[model samples]
Target: KQDSVVEDISAGCGVINFKVNRKLLVQEDVKFGLTSELFNTLKRGTTLVEYSSPNIAKKFHAGHLRSTIIGNFIANLKQSLGNNVIRMNYLGDWGMQFGLLGAGFGQFGCQEKLKQNPLQHLFEVYVQVNKEAEHNEDMKQAARDFFRQLEQHESEAVSLWQQFREITVDEYQHIYKRLGVHFDIYSGESFHQDQAQEVVQQLQSQGLLKTSEKGTGVVDLSPAGDMSSVCTVLRSDGTTLYITRDLAAAIDRKAKYHFDEMIYVTDKSQENHFHQLFHILLAMGHSWADRCKHVPFGLVRGMKTRSGEVVFLEDVLDEARARMLHNMSQSKTTKEMDNTEDTAEKVGISALIVQDFKGPLLSDYTFDWDRMLQAQGDTGVFLQYTHARLCRSVLLKITKLYLAGGVSIFALCDLYSYDEVLYQSAQDLQPKHLVNFLLKLCHLIASAHRELPVKGSSQVVAQVGRLILVDSLAFNIQLYTVPLCTKHKLI
Candidate 1:
């Protein structure tokens, strides 16, 4: 086997001479089956990933961005592994908040402003109404009245609410496009209102619902049957709470998709809420609730842009793009571009995603612009730069082997190390492992590009073998990276 392999040495254009042993194992020769084997063992069932459930008429905050990207990553990974994955964005488009928004819109909303920017106009109205309702009894009553009308589906209230929902969803679709995220099902609490009512009635019939002193409905989730823990289902005003709607949504999804598992992506603060939701579902005799899961992430604090504090998703993305654009403009190595803005956007978003993924999902971290956008270190900017360099180097019109003479080819290629890193990345849902792996790969490729001659080589077989190594490196980097960026629309 060793003699069967080809060996040669090459020197060209003052480039360093290197040799390839006959028995050397290039990256292509190393078989990595750990990740593939694990993936194949998965049950191959449908998975519904519910994430980024932002409320209608509200600014898209940092928490929503975390959920959005994290959910997209999970969905992408599941799909890559052959699961039937469904990405669901459950909007918070119901409850007393809508009542406040309705009354606020009635008081402060301008039709012209709404026509120009529906979401922004509605958000301003909501903020103003909230402030006024705090000190004015009349405003509070008006909000309640508006919400009551909505609950009753009064023609006027329903019309206004429908318009609000449509406009908000339309705006969200565009923003999601910018991020490369999409949803197969866009549902909300409003869609399950009737089902929520049905659930309450059913719980009452089963004697699982108890009326509290305040005229509220509660479900005892205690394992000892002592009612130590309770979950609220209905408010005193006979209005369904958020959990009730969630119950309806879960049951509805189970019936519709028949998914083997459902995952909810949200901040850690809502961990208890999900616990109650799943518990209540189980208590309600839904055996499938056992398969439901909540993947809670930590908070991202102090996120801002050049303008000011980050109040919306758009601001964060825009900040990223602007800063990246500035950096690219100043860099001597930056290639002249047709679409500088698009390149900036992709690179900027990559920086954010890499920063976010570098840490544990449950560990809160303060966002820093300088650190994340740095051209060096383990930042997203570095990742993108490295990938671009690898692509450029591989595409260069040259061919020369760069391995040191008499050196073990295994040490140079590090095929086993790459396999191990990839296996770890696949096992753990963190991107840091993969990020580190690609960083190291980039360093190796850079060394090879500097020392190897691709255009003119004395040894044809050695040149071809080294070119194969470069090609393998580029392919692996793209294989891991393209999915992440594409899933988030950052690419």
Candidate 2:
């Protein structure tokens, strides 16, 4: 007799039926305070969120995963509250790095290996080639020759690099989608190569350009021609430096999107790079330079597997899924589970995401499996199980009320459970939602850490009485209590 949709999200006067229209059965819009307001106040128009800019044909590292997930979360949060959030994949698709990567890829690359395991193959070839190129004169000379060829518009190398770039992007796009990510723009450094020269010309026109002894072009920010006040735009060999492309890319984004705000998510090391880039932009009279922000986070260490090596992102996700399914095998609810694959995928990602999100963004930490999988503590499993319990608990209470003189029953565990979930989501609450969340989470932690003494263990009558009392109290306590949270935890 049971089916998909719940009887009603809000109370209904009409008879409940499975075939009822969704619009008729539920509220058209959900209500929450300030979530809508905060998002709207941040942006005047569409906001650009640039993330996961891993090098084309390079392995997407753990740090890249952090930036991708965090940026997407920010974007989703903004969009949900009603803003035109534009997700952009700003790939590191140009510069001398690519010149090196392209050169290395060409001399020692394999098409069959690349097609089968593209990222691993690319990394393997690049690393071996780079190592050899470092000490061996011939390899270094060949790499330089190949890069020079690419610069000169040699059709073979350029075409090969383009193909590698295209294939890698396609592969990453699929992977990102699996992780619930999609980018509206796939802009690259290569896209701004032509535009970079125009930026250089503009800098020179503003008397911002200075020449170095090596005949390279740089910007003079200091009174003297020291390196501190200036950044190298064009290398001594006439090649563009990394910041050169970045400056140009910023200008390009401004021109194209005219974004009200643009955020760059990367590691904390890039603070200086971004500072210089933004300063140069503001100095160049781009008034919208203030709209740019760099949200840098700490390093993630010990992101490895049983093999005792740095794990690939794909491998880690596979492990998460496997571990989650193994956990599911022992779960009492799994036998009643409707969609095993979908549930496994969701729970696996939740496990991974909650680990990162459970801590502060600025604190460096090593990744661990045992810590993230805890069920009796403040883990995703705990949160999810609590949610499921709330569904059942609320139904139980309503049923009890109906049997008790067909009158109202007091709201108990449901409110506490609601507050717990709300706290995790950063919903507005009494006496500072964040503080309440931390307090409640602390209460839950205390309960978990506590040891209980059994009363009347030998007497059967007393044992049964104590069991009933404890069970009743547990139902009520679980309904109102929150979980443990640290001062550093954000959302």
Candidate 3:
């Protein structure tokens, strides 16, 4: 069986390879790109993604990096596949932690220091207060009193909390901009405190809320009606717990967004938490909880800067940019470019993302700056360098050909596989497949560039070169344009 599209079929080592016609491949790719019929085949609906979620007034640690990027990737993938995606950042802005922080601020906080460096001042205050409250009975009482005041909506406590929350959000926005991430909504546990009380009332009315021996409000999750599996929703002191606030948040979002699905991205430690959350929701008669998902990722170990153990996300970003700038200066092939700092930042961030995304999402891996930023091998630096070389070698030439009415063509073989990989990535919500696909494509383009001569070749051969260059460039732009590649600028 022979066809025009199949140029040759060969069998070797019990495997068969089909050589696809280059011209037909290009035509098909163009059709696929223009129509996007593949995505149309998949069901499309509104998707809500909740991620990042650093506690207000606390440092954005490296552990948060996984959730932030993974959530952004899911949002990007959903949108690309024709789903209406809503990115939400759920801040931990309430609970006993805030009580301690409030009391600490009242005792040791300085207005000038807070205004100058809000997070730093708050962190210092928190540390100092924790040390004092460990043994000081009076200090512990002050924290409880402050939280009680907050719950009662005392003007002074509420005012201070509002100020801290606003300042923290303002600072976080700048960092998120650097990472090329944004959210449609900024929700917090504070917003649901009152609603959480109402949820407790509902649970009690439904006879699902049980009082444990310690006077805490709990829900029994055991199969045999035993108190073996219990989830606490309230403290004995009559305060709402994390799961209580989460229940309120879920119901609120369902009413507001009416999304078809919702995903929560968090560390693997919270797997049971989400399981208990959805189970409780189902038991409370919210069947839509069945559509909810928890995307748990493993921890990142040994992520440090030259100063010491990294405490903030800003430190990580700065360290990556500085190291990348030093590497660029030492490279013999580095070109003079505008906004060199911006390029270094993008490349460095890409290195971090590629390293984290190369393996299974739930596998804990050690972070090594040297390995991720390597110029060769399966590193992001290699991917960026390959793409830049392709742009330098043939982008301008291809543009001229197109301007002169030359027929446009794309790559052979991989174009078909690219779509399949993308579809699977979206379906499974895994990024490793797409990352590997792009890396393999980069290797192929690099090989084609070395062997094919485009500058002084016949029109047909030049078009073949154009096919490889254009398709590779297109694929790179499509995948890298997302927040995954953060601030990527084409050469």
User: What lDDT is reached at residue 125 by model 1?
Assistant: 90
Q: List ranges where model 1 is wrong by over 4 Å.
A: 1-30, 35-37, 393-428, 450-462, 487-491
Q: 2 or 3, which is superior by lDDT? A: 3
Per-residue error for 138 in candidate 2, Å, reads 2.8
- Compared with the true structure, model 3 gives a TM-score of 0.89
Clashing residue pairs, candidate 2? 413-479, 440-482, 440-483, 441-483, 441-484, 442-484
Q: Model 2 segments beyond 4 Å from truth?
A: 1-40, 213-215, 222-228, 331-341, 389-491
Those runs of model 3 whose alpha carbons end farther than 4 Å from true positions after fitting are: 1-41, 397-399, 403-411, 456-476, 479-491
What clash count does candidate 1 reach?
10
Taking the tens digit of each residue's C-alpha lDDT, what string does model 3 give over 1-491?
55987889999999897765656766655443323665775545999999999997676676688888889988887887778999999999998877899998989999999888887888889889999999999999999999999999999999999999998888788888887788999999999999999999999999999999999999999999799999999899888889999999999999999999999999999999999999999999999999999999888889989999887788898999999999999999898988889889888888888898888889999999999999988878887887776665456555533333333434445655666677767777889988888788778766766666565567875665565555456556555545354355333
TM-score of each: 0.87, 0.73, 0.89
Q: Report every candidate's CA lDDT.
A: 0.79, 0.64, 0.82
Q: Candidates sorted by TM-score, descending order? A: 3, 1, 2
lDDT of 2 by residue, 58-153 (tens): 666788888877777666645543558788987887655555677677678888998987878888887888787788887777777777777677
Clashes of 3: 0
- Tell me, by lDDT, which candidate is best: 3
